[model samples]
Target: MDELTRAVVQLEENQVIEIVRRELKKGTPVEDIVERCRQGMEAVGEKFSQGEYYLPDLIMAGEIFNSILEVLRPIMAEAKTRKLGKIVLATVKNDIHDIGKNVFKGFAEANGFVVHDLGVDVDPELIVSTIKEEKPEIVGLSCLLTSAFDSIKDTIERIKQAGVRNQVKIIIGGAPVSEELKNWSGADAFTRSAAEGVKICKELLES
Candidate 1:
């Protein structure tokens, strides 16, 4: 692996920031650097899935990745990027976890989607109201607790009841999400990783 990639995979915080600064000094495109950072994060996610890395590793990687994005955001804003539409993100009612949601938010924004993050423990009524007001193309529900599945189901049901279910695609993610739960909660898609969540959101919008 290259320096940047190695730094990220190893969770070398200082080295990661320094590498990004060096790349910027060399006149490298911010997009290239952002993509490299994402590649590193993807590797982290893969290691996490394989049990090679634990929650602390994921959390550290996320913090480093967020730092990288903070460095690149201004440049990215000035660059020309294809708009990937809007996404509404939240932790379902009664779930206080935001790690996965925050990670997904970074990926989504990096890929050019405008993300509206409705912070942790968002009520179904608020989600419904936000969907009505924002009319985002994708609704991303996150939950770290298995017990929050009911909240996810209720959120989706409320969206359907609001009569805008057909207008948007719902995506559910976090530790307990799966194809079975996706079907059970009536979500259009499910992913275990934030990276995959971003990809699925893109595909959902395109299709």
Candidate 2:
């Protein structure tokens, strides 16, 4: 990889916000840098899918991706009249692992989502209450374990039970859930990887 690609890849690995800003000052096009990051994430996702990389590496890549986004998000915000949409994100109950959660949050934020993170081991009731209070357009339920998939289910049911199911889109993911599981849970979508998941959410938000 060249300097720009290296910077973006390293940026995703290191979460170097300053490095991205410096590259922007070096006359690198923001679009180019963003695209480079997309490539880096795709590569990381591929590695994960191939079992060549573990969860920590994936999460680290996410940290890097979001760090640069912190610098660019304001620029995008300033240029655009409105963002795609706000979202509430969290890892569900009994799942203290936040590696995937952080990665997904990074992807969402980098994709221009204003994310309200509920943090690890999040409760279904709390997730519902946040929607009632924040009124975000999307609810992203993140679980890193098959054991924690119930939290995703419980969270979705709470949305229906609270009668807010019609108001917000629910997207679920983590280590074990599938698109079919997402459907089974009555969620709008399930993404296998963070970057592609953001694409789906962005497309849905735009539509």
Candidate 3:
């Protein structure tokens, strides 16, 4: 792991900012810097899965990642000419946790996807309405609490009832989301990793 990746995994916010700024000054490609950060985040996720880290740690890591993005946003904006796709993203109703959702948003945006974020504890009707208005190719639902599984299922059902389900692919994600939940909720895909979620969104579009 490079210093940037190690600093991020160690949750060293100041060092991360310093290294990123130095790298940018040294002419590192924006994509390469972002990839290093992603690698660090992936490692953090592995630690979380191993029980070496907890929810607070994940939240802290997200905050650090966001800081890094703020540093890169201007360069990224200047470099990006086209969007890969549009995604309507939100934390499902009855669940207010948004760290995972925000992290996913960062990865999605970094990968050239324009995201319409609905924020936390969003209603299914609003999500469906946004899908209709934005005409996005994908909808991404996020919830950390397992109790919000029903909200995910209900949201998809509402989309189907609204007759727009076929127009957009649905993806569910968060700590508790699984392939089984994806099946149960009528979603086309599910993932716990932000990077993996972005990959799935791409694959969904290709298919």
Candidate 4:
């Protein structure tokens, strides 16, 4: 394995940061560094899925990936790289959970999506208004509580009522999300993981 990839896969936070900084100083391409980090994150996710790593290990891997992005974003901005798309992301009303939302936001932004995060406990009306204002291509809703399914359904219903439903793709996710909830909420897709959400958004844009 490459030095950077090995550091990331091993969850060597200090080594990862140091190597990333060194690579940046050496003028390595930002996209290349981001890809290494993504590979590392994918490795961590696989380990977690295989029960070889614990939840805390996965969280640590995510944190390391986020730190890597913090170092690369400024470089990309300096290069004037255009975003792939705009995404409206929020944790639905009455559900203040944000860990999943923040993770998803980081993944989306690192992959070149400009995410306008509305923070936790967002109202459906505000989401509708934001859609009208931002005209984003995707809206991502997150909910941790089972009860927030109603909020997701109501949010989509509100968007439909506003006549903007057909103009945008809506994706809902979090602990309680499923195909059933996707259908019930009228969202275009549902994902259990932030990584899958990113993949889905890219596919939606391409389609």
> Which candidate wins on TM-score?
3
- Displacement of residue 133 (Cα, Å) in model 2 is 1.0
Question: What is the C-alpha RMSD, rounded to one decimal, of candidate 4?
Answer: 3.5
Judge candidate 2 against the unseen true structure and give its global Cα lDDT, from 0 to 1: 0.75
The sequence of per-residue lDDT tens digits that candidate 1 reaches over residues 1-207 is 778988999999999999999999899876567667777887887899999999989888878887887887776677688878999999999998776687778777877888889999999999999999999999999998999999999999999999999999999999789999999999999998777788899899888
TM-score of each: 0.81, 0.75, 0.88, 0.74
Residues 102-194 of candidate 2: C-alpha lDDT, one tens digit per residue: 666665665567889999898899998999999999888887688887777888888899999988988887768897788878889888677
State the lDDT at 78 in candidate 1: 74
**Candidates sorted on TM-score, descending:** 3, 1, 2, 4
Q: lDDT of model 3 at residue 67?
A: 90
Question: Can you write out model 4's per-residue Cα lDDT over 120-197, one digit (the tens) per residue?
Answer: 899999999999999999999999899888999999999999999998999998867999999888899999877788
What is the clash tally of candidate 4? 0
Which residue pairs in model 2 clash with each other?
Answer: 12-64
**Model 4 ranges with Cα > 4 A deviation:** 1-16, 26-68, 80-82
Per residue, candidate 3 scores C-alpha lDDT tens digits across 10-126 of: 999999999999999999987678778888988998999899999899889988988988988887678746889999999999999876787788778878888999999999999
lDDT order of candidates, top first:
3, 1, 4, 2
* Candidate that would win on lDDT: 3
Q: After aligning candidate 1 to the native by TM-score, how far in Å is the CA of 157 from where it should be?
A: 1.3
Determine which window of 10 residues in candidate 4 has minimal summed lDDT: 73-82
